[model samples]
Target chain A: MKSTWMMRAFALASLFMAGSAWAEVVVKIGFAGPLSGPIAHLGKDEEYGARLALEDANAAGLTLGGEKVRFELVAEDDQADPRTATTVAQRLVDLGVRGVVGHVTSGAAIPASRIYDQAGIPHVTPSATSPKLTQQGYRTSFRVIANDLQQGTAMARYAADTLKLRKVAIIDDRTAYGQGLADAFAEAGRKLGIEVVGREFTNDKATDFMAILTRVKARQPEALFYGGMDPQGGPLLRQMRQLGMNTQFLGGDGACTAEMLKLAGPALKEGAYCTQSGLPKTKMPGGEAFFARFKKRFNMDVQLYAPYSYDATNALIQAIKTAGSADPARYLPALQTIRFNGITGPIAFDERGDVREGGVTLFRFENGAWVAVP
Target chain B: MDILLQQIVNGLVVGSVYALIALGYTMVYGILGLINFAHGEVLMIGALTALQTLGVLERIAPDLGPLAQLAIALGVAVPVCMTLGFLMERLAYRRLRNAPRLAPLITAIGVSFLLQTVAMILWGRNYHTFPQLIPTTPLEPVSGVFITPVQITIVVVSALMMAGLLVLVNRTRLGRAMRATAENHRVASLMGVDVNAIIGATFVIGAGLAAVAGVMFASNYGIAHYAMGFLPGLKAFTAAVLGGIGNLGGAMLGGIVLGLVESLGAGYIEHLSFGFLNSSYQDIFAFIILGLVLIFRPTGLLGERVSDRA
Candidate 1:
């Protein structure tokens, strides 16, 4: 009787095998960001974007090399620190992830990109905008967002041409990202013949700016451009208003977020401008739909780089499909030339791995919300 | 001239907060001869606790006056920090008192990291927006120079607290006992000083002062985070050492001097360096002064206790 039962089980196994012959492939994509620091909110937002992308791709029944592929996200926290970023990048490479989407800060992304390049793994950063990241000629490094060069020029042109502000003062947090952006803005401002009145610097950890602000106030510039994230930018705005500077405030994408609004509180003045490195949410290919879906899934507003992350994840997946394999060796070439319309905009990389035809959208704080400037 | 005056005002306002925080360091060091590295974490706890309390109060009693909310917040922060200080003394520092000096110093650092981690878990790693209680209007007593009402309040409140602390440490029997213990622990114990209690009380009082300073710091900065205490704590320690590590008045003097140097250096760094250096080099002033004091005058400016002993 036992032999007869075994015979029946063998028959059932044979029937199941005959019905389906394809083996499923799991493609692992690594995500690295500061999941546990002052900017953890932005990091987590990037994580959620990658997670949602994988979920949607899996739901769509993606196939690679004629095998049903299920995309998986391997998330790691770099603490928004440069040293930690290199260590985590090595860990992700050791885990044999096909690709990585992350590194929310320029300081971390630059170092981590070298590690990925050495390991021959493709890394796409959703946020970090320092121009030096791509200038290093690391074939493995790619950026989905516009570099600070594009952003600074756009901001400078808008200030000089639209608002016609001539005299400007600049402040930076003296970080790789902040200094690089501030330098670019200053260069552009000078080229446009705008009189640069003063330049000052502060570290990222500083909470006080009275000494620097006082000196800047003495110049009485028509506008003030700050190159730093929201944590510093918001307080600077508050102090500037308190000191009655009444000058226009502008910054790059680092200061362009709903979190900045909250940080600035009532200090957020009307017509305070920021440049985001993509089309406004309403103007993206599927931006409005993506925003609604993201809000529903996460129960929180997108802080800043979530949509860029979503595009980055999709771009990686598209490259894998274009190569018809999940191996980094096979897909590295495909990634260089892949093009797809993303939630942020068209996704295509230049020779240096920067987004091609990258766009910047200007935003103004009005009535307690960031409204897109036409 | 106006810039110099403005910078001095900025320096003094910032220096006072440093002075308050430095007092705790000086007192603890005076009694125990140990640099309480975790004193900074205590300040962080005070600020974060106050922020959390204010958040809850604002939600439950939105109609409550801002001043009342601030009072309640401080009321919660002070005791909580005091208890934490007491526990730190009793549980961690007390056991290691008889051990090698390095052991307690390392333990203090460990305790500091532990508190920071716990705070991160409880309050989150993001910067919480500190509620504005006082008006933020800048009062320009002189043209081209600005000082806010909040800054004025910080200066006034810290001055009052310093005066109160002076009375507490110099005008009471408990104060006499504390002074005796600090002078010589063994002899003071033999003289019925309750050396252990005096040491414990110093920690509690320091924590209480830190709570007030923490509130003022968060108010002045308009934001608070788990890591907020670190820089201020280090600066305050520098102030303590500059004034003479165990001298209360010395801490105040050191803090003010450090603040002035930092402000003036940042304000004129370009002119000072022929456009090579900039205000970004502001934090370097503290370390430079700290090194100068340690090398040139180990006894500090007004350091009487240690100089007498040495």
Candidate 2:
């Protein structure tokens, strides 16, 4: 009787070990952005988007190498500073993340891209729009949003052709993203025969723009183009109005946010326009369902770039599934040529790791909400 | 010419706030002989406190007039900041009073960071749109020169507060005691004056000024955040030094001059640099002036002889 009981115990232990061997594998993916600064809201938005995607993927019971896999997101705060971004990237690499989903600002993304490339970890930026981010020729660097060159060109053309403006002034906040977009806009504006009236620059942290506006007022431009985030853009518009400068205001994706409406208040009621780097939500393939599901899960409205971040995360998962491996080296090749119908639109990368079908959308402030302009 | 006039108006409006903050730095340095680096953080706390108070008032008493709401917010912020100022000196600076001069300065910086971190925890890292209690609609005092009612209030309130501070310092018994304590701590104590109490009073008074400056700043800019006080604080410190670190009149003078220079510099920097540079160089003017002053006339514009300090 004792020998039979011992034999049964040994048999049960082996069966349990076999069951454990077939359990799900956990894969870590890194997300880095300014999680604790002025732009923390935007970073948190991107993070939630990635989290939703991972949760969905887990619910779908993904399998890799014939074993169930679970995706874990490791988020880091880069503070939107370039020096900190490189350190965060190394930390993620050290933590054994197979892929990364951010380094949100272009200033942060460009520097961090070098570290990811060196470590052989493929990273995709959901929002960083500076052309230099992808132009560095890093195989590991990919961006889902349209670059500054494309968005800037679209805004300049809209101003010149649609608005029928002959003269425009430009101002930038002297940040990597802001200055790059302004430069692209200026180049495009000159090519379209629009007379550039004034060019001014301010730091990102400054709130006062009375002096700049005073000078711009003297130039008497028909419209003004601002290349900066909404924090500065909103105040600039308010100050412009206070100075009695009734000029049309235009901005790139940075200034085209719901937060801008609150910041600019009554000032935005007249002649404000912006361009976003993707198609409007109504125009996207799976936008409605994604938004509804997101609201249900997060209990908050999607700010901006959340959809792109969701698509980026899904692309990484798809690439991992296609390669049938969790290793970075194995899935990188799959990621290079991965194609899918994302919520934002078709998701495919060209040789430079830029989305093949990047679209720009124009928006105007109507009834205190951003309305897409056809 | 009209642009120049408008820039001047902008400069004066901004300058008055700087002067208000500068008074805090000057008075503290006057009595303690320590540069309170955390003075700026005090301004931030003041603004945030007012913002919090306003939020509560809006919920509890929504029918209050804007001016009354503002007055109540200022009342709460002033006392809170005063208490903070008193605690800072008693808890942190008092222990390091006899240590090397650098000790108190470093401790002040540490205090500043601590306050900022605590604020970040309380308020989170988002910029709050400070409600403009004062109307922001511009009134053209002169043709092509626009000034808002908020701007006028900032200037008028600052001048009145400065005048009140002057009378308190020059015409009150407390002021005499403060002057004695600043002259010699031990001698002031020997003369039966409560040296500690006088020093504490000085801090409280200065903090009150900073609270007002904080509200004015947020009202003018229409936004407030955890890090908002840092730049203005540094600029105010420069203003104090430009006028002479411990001199009251000098701080006011330095603030207006610095503000005018900055505004005019930003307005015409492109032309001044012959198009090679632009208004982004606006921050360079303050530091450049500080450097020039330190090298040429360290006594500052209104500063007396160094021998008269003690």
Q: What is the TM-score of chain A alone in each candidate?
A: 0.92, 0.94
Q: Candidate 1's error at B165, in angstroms?
A: 1.6
lDDT of 2 by residue, B1-310 (tens): 8999999999998889889999999988887888999999999999999999999999999999999999999999999999999999999998887888899999999999998888899998878888999988898658679999999999999999989988888899999998888788899999999988998898889988998999999987888889888989998999998988888998899899888888998998888889877788987876788789878888888876344553
**Pairs that collide, model 1:** B243-B250
Candidate 1 chain A vs. true chain A: TM-score?
0.92
DockQ of 1: 0.60
Give stretches of model 1 more than 4 Å off: A1-25, A63-68, B305-310
Give every collision pair in model 2: none
Candidate 1 per-residue lDDT over residues A1-374, each given as its tens digit? 99999999999999898666546777899999999877899999999999999999999998865688888999999988899999999999999899999888999999999999999999999998999999999999999999898889889999999989999999999888998889988999889988889999988878778889889988989889999988888888888877777888999888987768877787888769999887887888888899899999999888778999999999899998888888888998999999998888889999999999678888887888888889
Candidate 2 stretches greater than 4 Å from native = A1-24, B304-310
Please list, in the order the candidates appear, how each scores on TM-score for chain B only: 0.96, 0.97
Which numbered prediction scores highest in DockQ against the true structure? 2
Residue B121 local lDDT, model 1: 92
Cα-based TM-score, every candidate: 0.94, 0.94
Interface RMSD (C-alpha) of each candidate?
1.3, 1.0
